[model samples]
Target: MTLEGKHALVTGGGTGIGLAIARDLAAKGAQVTITGRRQEVLDTVAAESAGLFGLAMDVRDEADVIDKVAAAVAERGPVQVCIANAGIAEGRAVHKMDLAFWRNMMATNLDGAFLTIRESLKSMRETDWGRVIAVASVAGLRGLPGAACYTASKHGMVGLIRALSEDYLGRPITFNALCPAYVDTEIVDRNTASISQRAGVSADEAREIMVSANRHRRLIRPEEVAAAAAWLVSPGSESVNGQAIEIAGGMM
Candidate 1:
């Protein structure tokens, strides 16, 4: 589907699934604005996509999010497509999790999404159409061991999307969440190391453990999730509102 002239914004768009989605949107003729904490990573991705603009902003910072999104809209027009994909994935058992760890996850995954969507909606409401997509995880759908904080954060994001969908029922906008399991990204690499150290297992074993987390017994490609994001923005998906489309290889 063509998104010609549409302006799309993706948070954490520097790498992994966010970068993949940003590239897909850019290829489909949308002027994409990608935001991340690091300018270097954003620059690298922006270099590869002609219409993609990179902005250095941290989603976890409320003021920064407000300023950057406003700037993006001023430069590229309204954000018809907003993807709340900035997040932190960390696993810590509930009892052992400190307040700082829990707060960080909640701030990045939940608060960041709220700020991003809220700010974008201001400009989007003035337009005729809009799409808000949140990149949740399988953890959002169910509890995973040693990931209480992470799961809670994702679950909160899905909750926010669902509530917004209902609040704007008749509006020309859609809110949805994409839930994927064990995607092959930097988060997985970090988790592998953590698991290996925590469980006293070899790194290979830790990797296998994550691969087995998915029902398909394999790690998902970032492109797979990106394809799902693309579909959500396609014309055929106009009726697919308030849904959490899981990409966990039949795990759902």
Candidate 2:
């Protein structure tokens, strides 16, 4: 069915895959609320799209998530779709990794998803239909050689989604995670620079290193991930709960 008049909330929607998903949902006739830490970026993007609104909220803060999500529900009606997409991607060798680095990774990638999902569920439970899509990573399915912390965080996110799906097995709501590999987003740009400096390789070489991670030898597009998300929240997806759909070009 179309998303006409439904309310969809996407975290980290200022840019990247989250923004792409927000745009797609809005185009499908959903009233979308996109959240990020930057009001300006969120506002600018929302301003350009009809039926898309912006809010500034950090998922890492439980109180903030609770309040902001409540406010969104109060204004937009019950949230029929919730996407937890805010995350940080950084790699560090086990030996050189500090406790601060590990904690930060877990807080943003795992804890943030948890808080966002938990808060959203309150409103979702009051409704008859709902969808929760967590933006996980392919690293969760296996491992990334130097990204132990990030991999663990993503694994946690996938686990959380899977468990939630089971918890609501007989309900009208569904919980699923999208695992994508090396998408061509701003995160990749930042990762390219980080990899170049860490590996002492040229920028182009570092970029290729990531592209090679995907079996297709290319960067996956943000729209591809957005499309998967759109389908998950659309009609004919009622039985697709708890699955982590991999967009990794056969990397699975």
Candidate 3:
């Protein structure tokens, strides 16, 4: 159960689910590189864990992903586990959405995941084994109300992972996605405020709206997703490809 010599990269690893996964990989003896747009946040978190290195990189920018990831490989080794986890989530009705809003959602969620996976694969494919995991949303499997743009972007992310899985079916590399609902992260905390402002409700009331979406009627912890990620990259997960594993406490 040791990834003693593996090199891993997690995009948007400064906080939330990405950070949890990065820490877990580091704990398992992988030289993990955590990337995000915020340097301070990355530095702060990386210091708390062994084998975790923070590099400030934006997933939405192609040049940044290519150069930074290449540098990470040179400093450590080829990336054997690539987690395309950087993304943004927001809710807005279709009729009221502007072009910037729509494009912003797609650019960060779908385009960012694509760029991260493609760049990481440059080094990952050089190795005999690899894992590519996309942190998609439960919304990807079903239409989310008042979030058409977000739903579309996640669907694209899931589609990309599925297609890549089929293309690399016989290879040692595997592609999969984790679709979680109502994670108890900063994103949900912020969304509560946004929902309150938009819908004229109390922040607590708005938060409950998201919490109730989960079948368990509670927000999920970040470590739960990290556990799944650790399993996917472990030695025996070669057959677990092209799956969008839902973590919503029940079937969707």
Candidate 4:
């Protein structure tokens, strides 16, 4: 499906799944704005594409999110396609998790998605069409050991999107979430190291543990998730609102 002239915004678009989505959208003729906390990373990604615009903004900060989105709207027009993909994934047992760890996960995963969607909606509501997609985790749909805070944050994100989809039932805009398991990203690499250190196992063993987490017994590539995001923005997905499209190798 062609996205000609559509203005799309992706949070944490400097790398991983978000960057893959930005590239796919740009390839489909959309004017894409990629936001991240690091200017260097944004610059690197922007240099790779013609229509991809990069803006340095921290999604966890309300003021930063609002200001950057406003700037993007001013320059590229209203964000008709919004992707809230900024988040942190950390696993700590419930009893061992302190307030700081819990709050950090909530702030980045849940609150960040909320603020990004809210700010983009201001400009989106003025338009005739729009789409809001949140990048949640499989943990959102089920209990994940040693990830109580992270799982709760993702669950909250899906809940928020489902509610908003219902609130705008008849509107042209759609709200949905993409839940993927064991994605092949930097987060997975970090988690592997963490698990190896915690369990006193080889890094390869830790990685295998994550791969086994998926029902298909493999790690998902970032492009796979991007494809799902692209399909959600296509015309055929109009009737697919309020859904969490799980890309966990049939784990859902």
Candidate 5:
């Protein structure tokens, strides 16, 4: 049950779901390296939590991801648990979406996950056991209206994990994605404003729309997603490979 010797890496670990997962892993005795674009934000969080080290790195930049992950490995040993949680979510109708918006969405949500996992695997492959978990969205499983690019990017993440699972079938490492419905994070807050402006609704009504989208009629908590990530690395989940575990209130 203890990850005393394990080293975990979480991208976008400065806030929201990533921070929750990072703190949870650290509490479980893993030395967690938390990466984000802002050094000050990461440093503040690291200072408040034991076993959590802050590293400033941008997932969208290949060289930054490579060198930063290498630096973390140099300091804390190989990353035994890698979480690709850095992403961006924006909703725009297909007809209204420009190439710039679509590309930026893919770059952060899809390309970022690819780079994070590819770099982490370099060290994780040398270890006896490892875990790679991506914080994808429920949109990964089903098409979502008004967010075509976001949905497509998440679908790519789920496919990546599934394919990697097949490639490493007999290995001790497990690849998986945590698909959660509208979690109560900063992203949701931003989305609420965006939705309100677009739909000509009150901010509260916009937020309520998301809360009602969940089958259980409530936004999810970041800690709920973190719990799923924690369980994936636990000794009991050895056979849970390539699964897109949903934290949604109910099946989509």
Candidate 6:
């Protein structure tokens, strides 16, 4: 279907799943504003894509989120498709975790999503149709060993989407969360190294541990997740609200 005049805003759109979704929306004729902490990264990606525009904004900061999203709306019109995808993942055993680590995880993964969607909704509310998607994780549905904080943050994001979906029921807007298992992103690369150092294993072994965690025993591609996001905003997705759609290989 064509999103000819729709405006989309994707946080962390500089790379990985966010970039894939941003590109997908742009390909479908939406004017996409891709935001990230690094302006250069966003600029480089925007320069390479026709309908993608770069806007540097930190999701963890409420004022920044409000200002940047307003600027984007001013330039591209209302954000008809809002992708709250900016986040960070790290694994720290509960015993070893500190207040700072927990706070940072919540700030980036949970609070960031809340701020991004809240700001996007301001503009989206004026439009007749809109899609709000949160890039949550399988951990949101089930606990992930060794990453309690990350799991909790994802759970919070999923909860936010579900509540918003209910709040906007009967409206032409839908809210959903994409719960994927171990997508092949830079976060996984960093986690692999961290796991290797902490688990006394080789990098390949650490990576294998993650790959094996998936029911299908493989790492998910970012594009696969992007496809799910694309479908959620398509013409026939109006009834798929208040749901946590898992992109995992199989039921986990």
lDDT of 6 by residue, 109-208 (tens): 9999999998889989988999999999999999999999999999999999999988999999999999999999999999999999999999999999
lDDT of 3 at 185: 93
Model 3 root mean square deviation, Cα atoms: 0.8
lDDT of each: 0.93, 0.93, 0.93, 0.93, 0.95, 0.94
lDDT of 2 by residue, 28-135 (tens): 989999999999999999998788999999888888999999999999998889999999999999999999999989989999999988888888899899999999
lDDT of 3 at 96: 92
Q: What is the TM-score of each candidate against the true structure?
A: 0.98, 0.98, 0.98, 0.98, 0.99, 0.99
Candidates 4 and 5 compared by lDDT, better number? 5
Looking at model 1, residue 16 earns an lDDT score of 89
Off by over 4 Å in 4: none
Clashing pairs in 4: none
Q: Lowest-lDDT window of 10 residues in candidate 4?
A: 243-252
Looking at model 6, the pairs that clash are none
Clash pairs, model 3 backbone: none
Error of 4 at 114 (Å): 0.2
